[model samples]
Each structure stands twice: as structure tokens, then as C-alpha cells.
Target chain A: MKISHAICLSAALATAPGLAFAQDFEAALKARQGQFRIMALNLGVLGGMAKGEVAYDAALAELAAENLETISELHQAPLWPEGSDNMAIDGTRALPSIWDDRADFLAKWDAFGKAAEQLEEVADEGQSALGPAVGAVGKACGACHDAHRQPSS
Target chain B: MTGGQRLSSDDLSAAAGDGDAAAAEQVFWAAGCASCHAAPEAEGDALLTLAGGQRFPSDFGTFVAPNISTDQQVGIGGWSFEDFATALRNGVSPQGRHYYPAFPYPSYAHMTDADIADLWAFMRTLPADQTPSAGHELSFPFSIRRSVAVWKWMNLDDEFVLGAADTESLARGRYLVEALSHCAECHTPRNAFGGLVKGRWMGGAPNPSGKGSIPNITPGALDWSATDIAYYLGTGFTPDYDSAGGHMARVVQNLARLPDGDRQAIAAYLKALPPVAPLDGGG
Candidate 1:
């Protein structure tokens, strides 16, 4: 009885990591997509205000800007693990190029973060300056998407 | 006005070369002449020197821009206005040889005689460089200039590729975009023979630079409003505060040179385009 209990415990310990790793991968994928969706939603609000499609409200703009700035600051590097690319997983548009060119990807991400910070800083500048600030942020996002993210319909 | 006959190509060329510099300058930027004709790294006043040695990479191969500066030997300086008109409207070199479509003359074919003359006049003012342009590096079947004749036969038409614009603003936008800027050359999809796939106009396609795909600007793909589009053209930023980069960064610089109204017009036109779902990745 003592030998059987020891064997069972050892086997459970041996196989546990593999099962946990699979779950971790799925969670990472969900986190990655979730982050992008949040970013897009925040961007859309800011975009509408910038284009005058939606009336400029300082409070709303600041909120959107804050959201974007926070998202940009998030530690997203872990979300893009090796097998998270579209080639490795379904429902993903992250190209393998992101992994292949990790340094460039990080640089672009840094640029985006800087742009987001700029947006956050200028959010209170009212309608006049916000348009251009928002544009800067959009361009930074586009720069990363152009090189790293695969386009989806 | 002799016998009410149209002015000869020589007469038009001479008159145009002496025409209003300011108006011609507007056409110069509107037509994006400096983007290709200017030296690759040229900036400031050097952009006015159309020495022409830019390399455009495509699926077929790399194409080197030719000298259009007023150098008598190596450039079009010595050519008559008719020569210039022929090159723009027909994609034929002054020597009667077929020019590669890389010059964007297919769209230029729809340009008015007045705009052509104005543009030709402006080209004559540029400082000429004596250097001969570099050769194109294309695959066997593509390397032959005569082969372009066949391609032109199938693709080249004098009529507007898209339908006529309904409103006056739309018309202006269409003229600037379709004829002068030729945005579709990069934005639209291409067929197996490297011809523009008309149905997918402005749908965005793979980057010929082999980096990634271009974004779809049609309403279906891009959600930016007219103001946003104009802001982007003038400032190189998306409505969401992303700045334009890559080749488009250069294009935005050129567009920024235009007047505010012109950029607005372009934005209006983009907003008016029919929505098209992106067929593949990369917008």
C-alpha cells in the first residue's frame, strides 16, 4: 500500500506539468486576443472624437486615452509566446514574423507605447491638438500592424 | 489661331514651358512627379533635380527610374512637348519604344492636354543631370520591352477605369486619385500577368517590397471618417493617433505638400469608396 501511494504521487507529478502547460498556452492566446480587442475599442472611441464624428468631450477623450496608454504599458511580451502565432494556432492573426524578428517587434511596440503616452499627455489639450496626437498614435499602431500583425477580414 | 487648327506639339511645348510656374508647381506636387523622378535620397531643393535613379521592386523584378531632367543627352530636355505628351498618354519613349508600366503612364493616359502641357512645362525647369539611368533587373519574359506592347494591348485604355464621379467634389477627388496619383497601382490587387484587378479597386494588396501587405482603404476595411482621412493625408496619422510609417510615410510627405483643400478632397474620395472586405491578411 505504501509503495502504490508513492508510485501514484510520482506519476501525477511527472504528468502534471505537460497538462498545465497546454492550459497555459490557451490562456495566453485568450489574453492576447483580449488585449487587442480592448485596444481596438478604446482606439475607436478616440478615433471618432478625433474625426469629429463624435463630439469632443474632454472627459471621454481622457478616459479613452488613459485606457490606451494603460494597454500600451501592459507587459504583453509574455502573451506572445512561441506557439501563439497564426501558423501555430487557429483564430490568431499574429504572424510568425513577430517571433522571427523579435527585436524589431519590441522596438515597434516601444514606439507604440511612446505614442500612446503622447496621446495620454495631450488628451487634455482639447480638440485642436488631439487630432494630430491621435493620428500619431494611430500611425504607431499601424506601423506595428503592418510589420507584425497579420490582417484579418 | 491659324485656320482654327489645334496648336502643334512643338508650339504647345514651347508655350507650356513658358507658362505660369505657380500653376505648374501645383500640378507638380499633385501629380507626385518628385516621388519617382527625384533621386532616392534627394531632399530640399535637390528634389527639384529629376536625375531619376529610384528602384521599384515588384514580383517581376526591380525597375530603375529613368532621367527626366532637362539634360539634353540623357534626359527628356531635348524632347519636344509632343514627345512628352506621347510618353505620358501612350507610354511610348521618345524613341517609339514601349515604356514599362512602372512609370504609371497607364493612368496618366487619362490626363487632359492642358495638365500634360503644364506638367511638361514644369519638368523643363528642373536641373538636368547627365548621368544615365540604371537598367531594370527583370526576369526573361519581363525584361523585353516589346513584351509590354502585348500587355498594353490588353490593359491600356483611354477611358476612365472607374465610373464617372457624381458630384463635383467627387469628380475632383477622382481626377486627383485615379489620374494624377495613381494610388491603385499599389492599393489595388493585381492579376497573374501583373495587371490591376479592376474589381478589387482600393482593396489593398501585398506589398511589392516583400515586407507585408498594404491596407484596404475602402469603407469595408478602413473606418476612418473623411476628416480622419484628411488629417492622415496632411499629417500621416490615423484617427486613433497612429502615425504612418514605411512607404506610406513617404507618400504622406508628398500629399502633405498639397493644399489643405486638396488633402480634404482626397479624404472625401476615400470615404466615398465602396466598402470591400479584405480578401487576405495585411488589410
Candidate 2:
């Protein structure tokens, strides 16, 4: 995961300047990827319930849905600061489009948040509603990926 | 070897009067044209506007879909039914130029004359857009439209790639998946030059969209029962409870819009396909 350790060491020896910014960018990229992974895991739990792969436990669905809403609505603007794209940071699929089209990217993020909100609202609806609600959230995630996220390598 | 027949404009124009708009609408949905031709983020009635300029980045280059709306000058409005059939069946434009396979005519070549006529009539009912087309952005050799003729010679068989359909569901599934749905365009691996590799049909390949590989649907790879497969098409949920994400989510959206019979037929056909190990890193 440490893609630029050699470059970072060379830069540190060349100049004291820009090292902290580079480190911060690396941390931000890792943090967002980690955030997305956690969201996927949490969503998988709700998805299992929705698909009837796992027993429909209302309590567990609520917990998973709430966790998804929390992660989606969290204020993590710093995690997407410019220069954290795949071009700047290897091992990342965050395309330059995210920074280039900031408004669209943020709007897509908000779309996910709205979908998560809907899921949270309906998590208590048991079997029938949970399936469709989870689907809505999945659609929102895909919409964001389609417009903003680069395809995974 | 049901390569499409060329419908005379007279025949199609007459049939146009008797075309079943309801059935034509089903063909439109099954063909998934809006998946590429419609503007990004288009919804509801906007899906009917065929002002195609969507850019699909590919290994060859970016292929910009042309406007197929009924605008006489920019779209296909002035095209005779024969002209349209020629493009769909033979990958030749009305001007007799070779069309790049990006239009998926290789699969569409199997369409019956009636289906094509129905589609033409249905498209005519949509709003015409005069929007100019943004053509393909390819480099040197690929940019040469004449070269597509050679590529077609090597790749375009225009036959049903699958085995004989023994059952009614299999027959219906064959039409829906092979002729109309064109599942092979992505799910099947292609050779170095981007022609579908028949030997590895539905064995999956590197995602043309550049995501992780598309999943293999061959029996060896996907062991889901027909019922599970149908359910996934309808609801977007995998057997393991994970929801489909990425481009598949859009495919599911379209599949969900289809009738239950269509979904079931797709599943039955998929399950009936010959088993093969994935060619690429397909799951």
C-alpha cells in the first residue's frame, strides 16, 4: 500500500518542504478507502438480510443501516482534498474527475447520503421493504461510482 | 445461421402501419439502447430522447454513440427501413460506410425483419433531436473506418453462437440474450483485437468499463440455480446477500423493468450454457 515510500524518502532528503503535505495526502487516501470498505461490510449485512440469506433480524438490520447512514453523512471533506487522486497517489482508483468536478462529486456523495437516510428510515420494515430499500442504496452507490469513481484496476 | 434479412422499405413501411407498439417497446427495453445512447443521468421521458453523445472509453479508443433520434439531418429520421436494416444487419451505414462494432450490430444481425420494423416504428414515435453527433476519438489505425471492414470479415459471423435451443424457454432465452440483450459483448472474452471469442462464450473477461472483471456466467463459474439467477435479475441481490454494484446495478435496473418471463428466460438460458473456466480473472 505504501506506493511512494522511495519517492517520499528522496523528497525528504532533497528538501524539508512539501513532505508534510504528501504525508497528509497519503493518509487521506487510505482513510477514504478504509471508510468505503467499512461501508461495504455494513451494507453487506443489510443486503444479507434483504436477500434472506441471513435471517431477517430487525435489530441487526437497524444497526447495519444506522452504521451506513453514519458513515455516509460523516463530514470528511478533508479526506478528498486535491492531490489524492490515482495520478498523484498510486494504488488508488480515485480519478482526477473527483477534483475536476467537485460539485458533481459532492452531489453524488449527497445522493448516497440520501439513500442511506432512506434505508435507515425503512430498516425496521422487516422483509419486503428492506430488500427494495437496500436496492435503492445500492443504486445510489452505483450512480456515484459511475459518474465519479474510477473503475477498480 | 439466421443472419437478418434485408426488409424492403415498402415492406417495412407497410408493416409500420401494423407494427405492435406495445411489443416494440419490449424490444427497446431488451435491447438496452438507453444504456449507452441516452444522456448520462437521464430519467423518465428523457430516456426516450436518443440524442446519443455518451462517451464509452475502451481499449481501442473512446467511442461516442451517435444520435439515433428521428431528426432528419442529424439522426436516422430520413433513413429508409432498408437503410436501417442494412446498418443493423451488416454494419454498413446508409452512406455505405462500415460502422464500428461499437454499435453491437454483430449481435443485432440476428434480429428478425418484424422485430427490426417494430423497433424502427417505435423509435419514430420518440422526440427527434437535432443534436450533432460527437464521433469516435480513436488513434491512427483504429481511426481508419475502412479498416473496420477487414475486422468485420474476421469477426462477424452473424450466427447464433450458442448451441441449438431444445426447449421453448431456451429458444426465448436465445433471442433475448443473444440477439436482443447482447450479453456476450461484455461477459464473453474477446481476442486481442476485440472480437468476441466464441470458444469462451460467457466465460467473462476484463471489465471493458475497467472495473474488476465481469463475473463468469458459465455453469462452471456461477453455480446459482435458475430461480436464484432470476431473482438476482429482478432484485439485484446475489445469492450470498451482497447487492450488485457498479455497472451491473444499471443492468439490474433494466432487467427489473422486464417481465418476469424475460428474466426467467435469461436465467434458464444462462444456466443451460456450456460450462467453461473463466478466461480472464472473472469471478
**Pick by DockQ: which candidate is best?**
2
Place model 1 in a CAPRI quality band: incorrect
Candidate 1: where are CA atoms >4 Å away?
A1-153, B1-19
Which stretch of 10 consecutive residues in model 1 chain A shows the poorest summed lDDT?
A16-25
The TM-score measured for candidate 1 stands at 0.67
Query: Across residues B104-172, which tens digit of lDDT does each residue of candidate 2 receive?
Result: 999888877788878877888888998899979987789998888778888878568777889898888
Candidate 1: count the clashes.
Answer: 12
Best by lDDT: 2
Could you report the DockQ of all the candidates, in the order they appear?
Answer: 0.14, 0.24
Q: Is the docking of candidate 2 incorrect, acceptable, medium or high quality?
A: acceptable
For residues A1-153, could you state the per-residue lDDT of candidate 1 as single tens digits? Answer: 657755664676597643222334778888877886787788777777776778888888899889988988888778988767776545567788889988988888888799889999988778877877766666666657656665443
Assess candidate 1 and give its lDDT. Answer: 0.77
